[model samples]
Target: MNTSLLPTRHWLLAAFLLLATPALWSCNSQTTLQKQLSEHQDQLKQIDDDTIQSYLRRNNLLTKATKTNSGLYVVNLVDGAGAAVKTGNQVRMKYVGRFLSNGAHPASTGYPASYGDPRYPQGAIFDNSADNRTVCGCAVFTAGTGLTAGFGEGLLLSRVGDRKLLLVPSRLAYGPNGTTGIPTDAALMFDIEILEIL
Candidate 1:
């Protein structure tokens, strides 16, 4: 074998060069892939919201009381006669919180059903349950204060005997970290029934 006669140097250089090219491209390629994934996720979320709004519009359902803000919408339902309420005024109610996308029960508590699993973390539920002296576990919340901005806003819009739906974005509900039943950065849906305001 006349090694000196062969273009071994050129062959080795070409192989090494080819190998180096992919390594460099891999880094850039991975970044591009991540960006595409993010874009797709965002598009899906937008489509989901658009579909929800379209359905609501087509139904022509009355919310009674409604609040829409930044990728979220809240609705309060009252009997034909509208009545208002104030927070810090003890209130009792039945409620069910669910995921808008899947309609899975996320949180529930009260009565015989009250002794069941409450899916998500609710400040009012946790706070009331801590006191055995509390009757019916009525909650005292100050509207526009002493609660998350969404909760406060929703409560303020609610009235006695009113069943309300609070739609909360991550920023107003759980933010970036998220809670037990809710996924990270997930939007929230709450169906609340106001039994009494003392």
Candidate 2:
């Protein structure tokens, strides 16, 4: 038995143990952080849902609004006489994109619940097809791809010339990677009118 080699072996064992311990701790810490983020998102989702219900009730739309299986609320203002729209059909339309008048409180929107969002007034338009027509011809999009998931779902429920008001939750809106002026997990609203289905 070489005494010098024995010391080297002991030092190597100690070094291995020290390195392994921190790696294990790092994995545990990462998992904990991920769990916390998920919980926070869940809380925000619940808050948004509650606010949507309150808005519907206060506006007397609780009974009038049709809640789709996936949670999009639609108010069919004008029923179209034209043929029903299909999944891949190209459609010409007009739309006004707006936030929910932001019923969410400071917990999500950073504003008091009593005072509505000044930037996004009750009916103020954040985006509209008339303006976008110069850009990508916003008045047109394929039934399944051009719009957000909730928006597409709403369109599928309509026929050419149908006018609808869609209440889209954040999960179905821009989602985590928000669009310009919109934040993460924000529920949105859209006033849409189908001009023609091509």
Candidate 3:
């Protein structure tokens, strides 16, 4: 009720507001980032869908390739002689990964300069087996784990000795924030040859 106490109360309220400002600002900033991420994801999906459709049309693969439920497009180049790969199986394979922006050329010989691997000089090849010399090693991953959703799903659809070309959307690969060597919101194409299933 005293006039003197009014100034003290005002100062206390001002200090409280000042201290709370940063927390409020952080929440607002986080919300903004999340919204941006969601919007970016949508943009990436549209870009990927358009790119895949274009590639399919240009390559005359629209009839041969089958679209999976998750939106992956799988075109089998060779039928496997061995059993089909299943979830939880260990797979050894060779792969060449490239950005969809580089076009749909799947041949091993002529990759764009921008997409060439320094080690290969001609083109990049990713392998996970120890015996292969042309590539470091064959790609080995447990089906349904330790790999991108697209790649894993693609593997499950293949069998040993099967060669497949996969069109992977960003969400199934690295999402809106891609990892090193892959750009953010970039769609990917993977040429995979299954070598073995352990």
Instruction: For each candidate in the order shown, give its overall lDDT on alpha carbons.
Output: 0.53, 0.76, 0.73
List, residue by residue over 108-180, the lDDT tens digit for candidate 2: 5442233444655644567888786465445887998778899999989989879998988767887666777
Candidate 1, 163-193: lDDT as tens digits: 7667654456654455665544444556677
In Å, residue 151's CA in model 1 sits off its true spot by 2.5
Against the true structure, what is each candidate's TM-score? 0.48, 0.79, 0.75
Instruction: Give the candidate number with the greatest lDDT.
Output: 2
Candidate 1 at residue 160, lDDT? 74
Weakest ten-residue segment in model 3 by summed lDDT: 104-113
| Better model by lDDT: candidate 1 vs candidate 3 | 3
Return the lDDT, model 1, position 78. 51
- RMSD, one per candidate, in order: 10.8, 3.6, 6.5
Which regions of candidate 3 deviate over 4 angstroms? 2-5, 102-137
Ranked candidates, highest TM-score first: 2, 3, 1
Segments in model 1 whose C-alpha atoms lie over 4 Å from true places? 1-65, 69-72, 80-83, 101-142
TM-score for candidate 3: 0.75
Q: At residue 117, what lDDT does model 1 achieve?
A: 26
Model 1 vs truth, CA RMSD: 10.8
